[model samples]
Target: MYKLGYRNNNCIGCVKGGAGYWNKIRVDFPEVFKQRCKQSRAIGARLVRDSNGNRIFLDELSPDAGKYPDEPDFQCGFMCEIISKENNL
Candidate 1:
């Protein structure tokens, strides 16, 4: 199961959080974030503020929603690598 948490104004459980995390993911893997955004936009999803004041994609709250790691392989690779690099893994 995917564990969820919060960090600052970010939802730790969602890839839309963490500038360093998302930036690295985008910089190192633009294609992945792009594709993921395409899919997200297709579903009319947006990065919304949760009750905790953290930003997270609305779809992420759904039980059937996709996890960050469940994104494209390149995106997953970047997330895992960056998380490990930042010692957040």
Candidate 2:
């Protein structure tokens, strides 16, 4: 995603994203959302866990429902930092 212009490594249609975020993704990056849904089904998993304890697949999410998940407002550091730390680099 960083290579695609996103600042962070968050997955496409991140499960953590709330309704507003997903809605925006649905509007702005429909193809990504669709692909994520397809991949999720292939893996037999969904990204979203609803309050009702139901696994709400991305395909089943209501475009108008869901709240944007809170995220840090700043970005710096590359994903390599995490990889290096794990490898004791």
Best by TM-score: 2
TM-score of 1: 0.34
lDDT of 1 by residue, 17-80 (tens): 4333443345445676566556666876665444465655533433233343433322245666
RMSD per candidate (Å) reads 13.1, 6.2
Candidate models: Cα lDDT each = 0.46, 0.65
**Model 1 weakest lDDT span, ten residues long:** 1-10
Residue 46's lDDT in candidate 2: 70
Give the best candidate by lDDT. 2
